[model samples]
Target: MAEAASVTTTLYYYSIFTSPPDRSRTSSSSSVSVRRRNPSSLSWVLRCSTNTSFPWGCDTDSLENASALQKWLSKSGLPPQKMGIERVQVGERGLVALKNIRKGEKLLFVPPSLVISADSEWSCTEVGKVLKRNSVPDWPLLATYLISEASLMESSRWSSYISALPRQPYSLLYWTRSELDKYLVASQIRERAIERINDVAGTYNDLRLRIFSKYPHLFPLEVRLPAMDGNVALVPWADMLNHSCEVETFLDYDKSSQGVFYTTDKPYQPGEQVFISYGKKSNGELLLSYGFVPKEGTNPSDSVELSLSLNKSDKCYFEKSEALRKHGLSVSQQFPLQITGWPMELMAYAYLAVSPPDMRRNFEEMAAAASTRTTSTKDMRYPEVEEQALQFILDSCETSISKYTKFLQGIESLDLDVTSPKQINRISFLKQLAVDLCTSERRILFRTQYGKRPGPGSGRFTDGAEILRRSLRDMRNGELRALKILNGFRKLFK
Candidate 1:
């Protein structure tokens, strides 16, 4: 997957009002009133009106920026291709087909000189030398380099590319801590985002104290601050393409051509928006990293990590803890619960944690073997204790589902008109994503609990158990179809 770059607020916002000429051309009558509130401080509000042509309310600026960027690319070694930029529902500016393009056609061939990579030599040798001497990693180094160049405006060689980048990237990195806490309380992504934010801030502070303050001549204060968080690259025209879960197109470096290229595997109509796959990322991941979520039931790669911990009151708690410690395993661990199935490691951990007193003697050996050996879902079964493990897993899934349900109820009660439309949409998407994960996990548990029936003609068969097992089996089979479809879609992307 191509890593999405973070936008430098200082340069990004400046570029928004300076280079985008058409932004000033919008008529007052058709403009929509937008209340722009600072994420950190709500008291600092900026009232602005945006034209309705852009669904995201920044159409004119994006169109102008795209136009300027296209002209620049045309002069900077971009091939004369039948592709152009246009406003799209998914993103502010997206590359669209200007003419009919056939399958297997070469859509874009961006020269290496135009691509902004961490490996590329910096224009400012002094600053570059400092960065290289300190062994700064690619992400922060590139982010700082971008800020330095962007601060120069027209003097910067990559000014045109910088100007085209979105002023407000929809990434979760830009979300305020308060906003994340409020809207993403029940989701796991919130915790990850908070950790990332802290890491970035810590990195920036460390550099400032160690390098920037000592060598102010080489590293200016304006450029020293960290602006990006994840692995990033600036692929001029290629960055304009939006993402699609169904698309097989991916961006890659062509060593032979010494440039970036993306080949089309499917034909596109004259006005169709060109899409590239950002990778097999789940909706939760997409929303956290890219600031958008795919439609429900569309992402096959989606899964949630459910936390499992040992029961404190269990009779064999001390024995199990000691065994887990020897194997360098914790009593509490996270397990990936996917729509198709779960990892065998999860079941192994569960079995160790919930094993009875009689089986405690073998826990050390079992834990040691389990840690080193590969176990499949079939091997997860321990007939003597299968029911207990299944019950524990079921309880965890139920608890998660209840939390998500509560969040959904809270969203329903909010006055939509008073809240930011973007916030509302994001909150709703997250709620649905959580619901989907919980539902899938619950289905798997149901299968484990009731997919099998009592042996045929067994006199012990009760009416209630028989009916319950039959109903569960039917539902389980139906849910399995969804998992099959998801796996098939993933194969295409791979």
Candidate 2:
């Protein structure tokens, strides 16, 4: 989503004053005192409040700062329209844009009502408390509350831009209903758990650890938007941009000064409503990272329903051999000889997962690599068939990839492992896995190109054709034999 823009004017506090009243009394007659100052001919009085009770006491300077902030918020102009509100009405109330636009243009200013520095030392708890105390009412969602209630508007320019407030990180603390009895207070712990699982805690812990180790920073400990400046929270006036694909604008910030800026990527004409992409930009790198296939026939104007988290049951792998073959590498393309697990361990998995043809090619290459690695390691007591084992393990890995990727890719195409924890509870995942393996075509790498017109003196395709047919027959027989062996093994285990 796009960020809010920086205002040209900077806020400054002048004087912290005491209200004209029985200053020491806790009666309702007490009032807050404030004074604001600026370099221009605009100097104003700001109000500072006191609780008048022992439970909530107000500081002198805080009152003064609040006063100054109030005056600044009051005098600021309206935002632009490219940043539309999700639920806010579009009458004479909110912001409006002054121009028309195309895709990727700056539509409005979205200032931060709450901004925390990227380098700040505050913890998630501190941030949450701050938001709870200072956040405004009327706007229920934090993202919306901070923007819609911050300021008043007059023209269309005011509607063009809104603000995004800073947020606290909230991790999903998982628990299972079956294991609730183990806790000190079963009902309370069960109520607190956002997700449920049938697996043992040890298993769950291992999965969580594996996920964190692979992608530590990728999962947010706290959910928050990057701020424009300072260690403060986003204000009420900004947060109006809704999700759209053919967006006109985006947010940018200055690292050193913490100032936020909004700029137009395209020209916005008067009266045209502005829009910004609410989801991550679709690029080659992002496509792989997120495992999002463009919904078939989806266009820029299509409505977005993005899933933000990764699915455990979906995994991805890469193909160094095919890529190398395409690039004319004969030695199995050693540099890209990479083994990535589910949740997209590295970038190559992204490229491999989206295209079925690519997936088929890469799986073959993985089989080859497994053979090579096993043969190389065999002198030491590795008794199992290396290639087959590795293929199973690779399939298992695919089952543990991110859920978000699965949602974006439309889960029907994944190669899942029924035994894996991620898919153990998912009937659809198991069903899809069976379908993929059963319906998939066999992979055949052409050692030499064939199926061409015979040369002038060529005989009726005798020796070469016979050899090719025999080789194909042998390959098919081997596959049948392997399937029988696997089926027998399963029956014996059962």
Candidate 3:
């Protein structure tokens, strides 16, 4: 995700243009419109994108960047490898096996010298010295380092690597606020996306106020990559590997080789595409970080968020709010709901929300159980509020389903803003992505209600957890004493 931007017309266009070969960091004539010769290499796959259009990087379908990156890495001490970058069906462009890659065989011995980190030498010495002096974190430092090197073009050692980065990485960070609201209106993921965008904006503003404004010439607005994956570092050839929901292997330092590599969990034919795991990420998570959503039911870890709120009319509202606040929760909370199960914590929160005055004694305990911070879990059941808890969840599920139903039925009606063909294409593409995400998410909610429609006269409220005949227990985050996870997917069969 190298944002190789030079001076732009506006401060926030966030373009990824390659500057002139002159390597001047402050030249006004740096931003060019033509494409450069992309190098060959086993460059990593940058799974991110942008909403604001400016020609920054090449198309993912093209192999010019990959080829260039490969040549550079090969000459720069990269070991012989069984895989090389190729056009693929899964992640657009990914590492494909050049030979029979076997299960358990470690791959991609990307040398330590090639990996980019905070400690990597900056092309701009002044920028590096100033950033380190301020005690910047690893994420922003690496982002700044990559941007600085990128601005230097061929003069910088990482020129080939920078050239390989996607001009527009496809993360939710790039999605416009209006787009998120209109497209992802049905799911709670919209909230997460908004929060993430705000976080990036906030970070950018903070840095501009503290550092970038003072050294504008050295740091030319790298707002995209920093918010991405605080836990991650930029790996070389390993970045080319695309994510598969099935694969359990991930890129990590191999102490034996003193470099980064991932062991193959599954066998691949010579021509087959190689895959790696991003994490045990849900469909919503993949969409958040990487723009793509997994096809329906293919991702075993796929899940949707279900939001639950305290009944304001309840007499214990103030007390419950205080208790939840102490445990770092609020009156309204979100829990992940999967096709197979729901977390026990969801049940605990629901119970507390629906608990009557008679169960006042256990309010604190229930709130504590709901918090992930609670090390020793306390699983308590209130038979008196059990039915109420189950109904509460079903009601919430119904409410969510209605919103999805409204959007899915006539999604095109929401695209009235498009006047030009370009705008139409953009809006339509975004709509399709939204439809895919919403459909997958709504599918889970639909399964939970046992064919229950949104309004009154819907199907009979299905049992939840122990009380929820099968749905609640089916989707459990873990084993529960009274029931299992909410098997929301099972609702479809009914």
Candidate 4:
């Protein structure tokens, strides 16, 4: 029996049951098996009543995917890191976990071909349209490139993800019929493409960018994984990792070895359900990238406490205050969401978009509870509102802001609290408020953390301030100097 190492995952039954072609091109026929020490009913393999690990010849659907992946790895001519797949049961569904990981550790290595360049056309819907027609030399980079390009065309209002794109795109989606008509303006495209472009644009762009960006140097332009057909594939891992936020873990990339390392990011302690984020922000970007429809907000005519949590550390250092003030979008992970509507539903869509096919059906059942019931009250029963919300999230993934506002009007009308005129009026107010808050929060927090200069006695601070003062006083003489006070504060807090 192999001991579960600090960087190992559960021994998935599939690793043993299916035999893939040689990925390393060393041998045409060879097989491996994993043995479990403690067998339980919840384990992945059913026949292994006494063995906790998968048997050598067990066959299952997951094994099929693994077998294919194994071949891709072998033929890539990369060094083996002793990684394997494993299954665990929790609540109503099964999950995959990468066994061990260390903080600030690297797991997978990808090629630059797989990395979506920031300069790609995703920044402009107009550009995205042109790229789609262009032939991509590599298919693995297709989805990511498309998404990044689409995101540049729009922004997100929902999740922390989209706002974290290299650039802050537009955030709203789901345009009004009139609004959609406006974009088609002398541009010869049809209304349907416009709608879809809008959808993909608004979907969340965060997870895709951050998870990949954090280890950008690892992945190469072309992926080399073993395929079952005795060939190798260049499938980008970014094309994989689907989007479950809960009950999920990932393989880290090793750039030196040019291979993927595995680890679990989620655990049973979090919950049994699968949670995924559309690769972008939750508001409009999510819908655009993945076509996820979020639940609409209920007009309960009552106040619901919007919950925001800060750890003890945050409160002690006034980090919470700083966050609230400095809350504009950043390029790093941990971007915040402007949740005015159904967060639960948004979470569900994200989970589904990235979840393995086996787990997606389960997500649908769990999310059904959040869906508006037809028998519910005026505040709750708004299928139309839900649809509008869904459309907005999807549209923002790839479309523009002017278009998103138009679609938001459709969502506001579904609220039943307003007529056509009121819907139009509310649209401007909501979009402005969301955008304004995003900017204000970022600025305030940034300033609060670095706003004050030290008193006269504080030499370092005094000197810096004096330099700035002197420079300003001599406006025509030279450029003013600036210090990185915020960076200093961050290090202190950490």
Best model per lDDT:
3
In model 4, which regions exceed 4 Å deviation?
A: 1-66, 78-95, 98-105, 110-235, 246-280, 291-337, 340-494
lDDT of 4 by residue, 1-494 (tens): 01111212122111100111111222223221111111111111111124322122222224444444445544554344223333323211122323443334443454433323322334334333433343222221333343332222224111121111111112122233454353322111223335443333322133225332333332211111101222222222222232332222333334444333344343322223222222222222222222222222211111111112223342222322232234331111121222222233332232222333344334334234223221212121222233333333333322333333444444434335445895656455444433332232223223222323222220111112422223224432422222356667778999
- For each candidate, what TM-score against the reference? 0.72, 0.27, 0.80, 0.24
What value does the lDDT take at residue 111 in candidate 3?
A: 73
Alpha-carbon lDDT, every model = 0.57, 0.26, 0.66, 0.28
* Alpha-carbon shift of residue 278 in model 4 (angstroms): 5.5
**TM-score for model 3?**
0.80
Error of 2 at 412 (Å): 19
Q: Tens digit of lDDT per residue, candidate 1, span 87-120?
A: 7775556788999998988767788777776666
| Root-mean-square deviation of candidate 1 | 14.4
The model with the greater lDDT, 1 or 3, is: 3
Question: Model 1, stretches more than 4 Å misplaced?
Answer: 1-61, 222-232, 325-328, 361-378, 412-494
Model 2, 1-494: lDDT tens digits are 01112212111111111011111112133221111111010111111123211111112112232333333444563343343222223111223354455545433333333232222222233333334353321111122222212222222122212211111101112112332222212111123232212222333244235442343332222111111111222222332222234543444443433334445555545554333332332221112111112332232222111112112233422343444344343322111111111111111222222324434645434333223222222112112233332233233223323222343245443334446764454444223322221111000001111212111111111122322234345556888999999999999999
Better of 1 and 4 by lDDT: 1
**Can you write out model 3's per-residue Cα lDDT over 356-404, one digit (the tens) per residue?**
8888888898888778777644445676676668778899998999999
